[model samples]
Target: MQLFIVGLLGCSLVLSAQALYSSSDDVVELTPSNFNREVLQSDGLWLVEFYAPWCGHCKSLVPEWKKAATALKGVVKVGAVDADQHKSLGGQYDVRGFPTIKVFGANKNKPDDYQGGRTSQAIVDGALNALKALVKDRLSGKTGGSSYKQSGGGGGGGSAQDVVELTDDNFDKLVLGGDDVWMVEFFAPWCGHCKSLEPEWAAAASSVKDQTKGRVKLGAVDATVHQVLASRYGIRGFPTIKIFRKGEEPEDYQGGRSRGDIINAALDLFSDNAPPPELVEILNEESVKKTCEDSQLCVIGVLPHILDTGASGRNAYLDVMRKMADKYKKKMWGWLWAEAGAQMDLEAALGIGGFGYPAMAAINTRKMKYALMRGSFSETGIHEFLRELSVGRGSTATLGGGNMPKISSAEPWDGKDGQLPEEEEYDLSDVDLDEEFRKIEL
Candidate 1:
């Protein structure tokens, strides 16, 4: 939902008090003209739910909002506004997107709101629970015995917001295939360290929001809900935070971290261009194999991407490959020829969408029938990758478990997988990295 100013309307003062019935959890009619008294005078905590009429997510949130309001009476009052219905109101508080549900009174006694989205239940629960926690804090004398003073609200918490919810769909849509640097924490609910480090991740996201702003993104894979994603990424431990630079690929940490620690990690990957997804689909076993095998001059497909791109960058990196191959023909080949990027058909064939950019996939048929160049390579890394693949230069290593530095490559050759298993089929429609979570809902 886009934001537009209400003050420009020239009619500012209107106090139509049509909130939830004292006996019913009906929708509240709060407008920009009346937000002050009805919302500001909330005895305890307030949850102003922002929604848009065209948003499917917002519609789903309606019933859940009513239920949460009903279940959470007395502690915090819940109210909702159709962001589309009241565009002017959205601008007054800087509401800048669709299906956004903001929660006021999240901090102790102070007024705070959250930009919560995704499904209705998650947003409704997060906001109400936050306010409920605030009420408990006030009752427990967290804020100078009054409900307005915050316990930890010293100079620490800003008049800023943190935390976002991403569904698997949007997670890929927005996060996966961009050129921006990204840091993701793979954490589980039962892990004590994961539970403790929540605030650190938030602080880091906030500090970088203004600077990294659109260049960097922070996300979490509730390992409890996304075990397959964790496994695919080789997440072996709790509180593991992984950072992906624009062209340098992704690096991960297995221990816990502080706000400062996470913030520092973010700065390391900052780049003006975010990695795109199209490049990643090219590196799935078959794609990497074909892209490499198709190259005759010890083809070099440098993968300089992190995690993988869903669209353009994959193509962009390939375009870079095409240019390099064409420019340095003498250094590459004719029968010993080299072309770059995913060979379109290969991308569609595997239904995989990463592994070509920020990486180097090479084949040295002279030495072995197939051999990968390496991970995102430095120019020197590129040479090292060729040498290692030269049959006697170094033994080929399996690609599954390694940090793949500037000078490492994954070789499906010389392994016990037994001749590649007839080009295993994969379809994006059937891909559910979080399917395991459905069996055990958190």
Candidate 2:
């Protein structure tokens, strides 16, 4: 009996130890004290999980979450918050449930919900998608980079800045061999446009340096002196801008030669080098809230009931959304979807049913404003609506009661081609139909 008691105590101790030790996953453990410094102010992307110790689902998510964290160690920061122990932190983001995953973008205050499957692959896919979206936004001039205001000035005017002077000797070593995205201006010393663009180029170099954390550079070559380099690039004009992407053929800068234009173009180049956006199906309130908080615009689609359309029709709708998303990759907007009647509150609030199935709504949740697509749901029609919205020309409406309608828990898409469930057929061989009908009528 004493031996049995001893063994039982040992087992209890083992379980206790396992429970008390913080997760061994590669994720950084977060608290209110360090959350701001580690996540908010950091430059890279972050995926954080808010969890409770006692919750079985949270416990189950640990292994897969850790695997994802390990896979994305340097590319994306992975973190976990013990929401049960840190009630105040949970309340700040309105985390009402256990095992809530949120993607914190460049903006720390707004976090998008993670509704991907609990598998390791799903988690990694979701993280990469979020990272791509953030990068795209930075490229779109929506939000990001060191804030540098354009001012009137000429080239090489006052202070030396980020643009480096490239001679024939250094051109091959710096521009061709290096991995950073580089913009090289080939110019003659006496060229008037080159002189006029000097100050704007200098200012842009400084901004790009800070924004890209030195992953991109600006350089200038005196075409008169570097004859060989100019010949190699086929530079015909006195002042020509060429973009050098590592391991790829250089592209000519065709945009306007203004400070704003240059900065926008450089940002686009940086984004093109970064990962493109990944689309995820909407499954819950956290996903909806987090998306709204993180993005300048959230495009949500309402599809017809699966029974009505089957897998073919459903897949068709999703394909359209995906293509449009790729076309507007620079917009850096969040794309999500739901069945027409699944989130009735959202459907009603957005008035999605009137236009029929497969309708879409572009929402600016931050301002509680939205614009609907009254046109067809094809690529052309959708493009027209977005084009107008992009220019601030679309008609808008205040969200119901000036608030984003609350979203509820929903089953996430299985990432499979939608196929309608087989319908059940029942037969009644010997029923008194007339008698039953007369009784019901009476």
Candidate 3:
């Protein structure tokens, strides 16, 4: 009997230790059971933290999270999930870290990572900023909800303007010949399932277009109207989706039929087809000009000199930039780095010298505006800096002299440690040092 009582007490303690937030706190404790109803289906903005109770960082964030929740009580919904206990929920949102904060703004299905600071004030500020963006999007007719009712049977809530109409004549040239990845839907006009998917397909098309910068396209064909095209692909169903890549066989789409699912799948295809952005060295005028002009935004990093960081240390910094470039590959941004003092004119133009070595600046070549990174050089810091610029929140300044500065030609960094310039040796054997000293003294 004593052993049974002790076991019950231990179980209670274990259960208690699993939960970090309580009823007294303003944070809403979320689990898989209530997550959909509380967050996904709700119209309001939500800031949710997926955290493990045993993590030291999670523990440290507890008080600040509570404070932020309390401060944002009426305006925003703040929630906490014990991800350690609810692995399914954590995995669903791709929460790989111990403490991951996601902002469920206008689109709950696709949440944005909270990239701001961890303090209560920072948390509150981020939530408010997100709220402001959501409001702005809604006001500009970028409604994210699934409540739009379709009046016609063929079209639903999907944005038809964004969806390319593929016919038998244009199907081969556009889908097969084009270099861009394509998500083509073979649909019949009278089919119920096709009607149901129209809105999702249309919405996904708009999102995919913006996110992939037209690298991935979404197209629809009337299988009933174009029997030859449908027969070639063996489209037997009402709405059969196939992915098309250049020089590759079309693969069947096996993802969910929601807007978010379609967008995610299309993004995956884009990433698979697209190569990582090249991390160029700012060696000359042509190098800098070509890279900046080709991309929507150019990210320039002034790495420490090879002498200071060594090859290993310089490679580490480059690795960080490469990872960030890969992460934001869809943005089609250019990544370039130069050794400190290698491109002094370029550094001065971007205002990089003030921040010292290992600094970063994101420049919009079109606007001739640039934003500097005032954060650490780590992954988390760079992610935060880029995320802020992405949402159009960060402060930007016009490029120096309202134009790109002249890039001085520089030698590329060899993958070796730097060496000091060899000092000139004097042929002093023919001369007398004593006589030279005496002459100088006289």
Candidate 4:
């Protein structure tokens, strides 16, 4: 009887309208162009739906898909492909029916079909179960090559350096230790928001390592499994982020879930110990050579000379650069600055004169490649430029003469107000009455 009903539904043909999803939906709409780039090559897990617009079940699954996608926005990527439109993709994945769901785990080539209830909660549960199994397999030496190398005898999964998985036994020793600040997340496996924050939290941990010199840490506690630790913290909800200062009481982290916001909050804890951007008068030999020697990149800015722009103007410009440096403190890069005319040779080498004062450049010192900022000197423009270079998408050029030029150090700002030159007075004897009258009339 079940086989007969399935066959009847498969054989029935009815024209259905184009499957339109809300524009604000978190589900990534996949096509042939983006399928390979976003799915096949990505390291994260993906739950995809292959649907035909003409099928009734396909239409029915749209709302559930949106819900699950919103719930698992950051942790896992939920996507949909129009099998009716992209016939080749549908054939490649071997889709035999409408609204076919496949879980693309670590290995994109081999995907497992999802067999679960057609409800939002059921879909989320199914996807999470797959993720846990995938993570377990990778940690247990099942995947050929994994992001994390298998270390012996730790019961808990994941690299300690990246994301520390906390248990009841080690919770007190690690969290209430003698030194360092900690950002702990109390979570339950079944919680949707907890799952959504997993990836972002892991990324924030990796980045926070370099920024804070390993003085700040990010750890996760499974609330359901580790009930003792959860109770100690009086955790009434899942996905609670708390800041643990070394000698002070733990405070709740009330910030946005975005990666940038998480990093900002962590840096705020390191305010006293945080390193400031290197402010130099000139790009001297040692200064230029040491900036990017041990780092991936270096951002150098040239500001107007004190004689040209007053101390107040220069200080305001430097403030913008400092704020940006603090924002990206976790990244492995150097933040440096110099006066406009102090390093004439270096300026000529970098072509800073063409862009006028307040010019900037990011250099990959290892590759001897550099990228100049072609936008405003404000925070937004600077962030955009640095982000492009960080992702390896910015264009580059070889250093002029394939080497850095010599420079001499100049005096730092005297902290006194600058004096602008007085306007020149016209000579009455040389003034032409008709020309002056014409200029004034115009």
Q: Identify the candidate with maximal TM-score.
A: 3
Task: Write model 2 residue lDDT over 47-83, tens digit each, in one string.
Answer: 9898888888887888898889899999999998888
1 or 4, greater by lDDT? 4
lDDT of 4 at 379: 99
Error of 1 at 400 (Å): 64
Overlapping backbone residue pairs in candidate 3 total 1
Candidate 1 residue lDDT tens string, 75-104: 566777766667755644456665555555
Worst 10 residues of 2 by lDDT: 145-154
Among residues 3 or more apart in sequence or in different chains, the pairs in candidate 4 whose N, CA or C atoms overlap within 3 Å are: none
Model 1 misplacement above 4 A: 1-161, 246-248, 254-256, 271-442
Q: Report per-prediction Cα RMSD to one decimal.
A: 24.3, 22.1, 10.2, 14.8
Error of 4 at 286 (Å): 3.5
Report the Cα lDDT for residue 108, model 4. Answer: 63
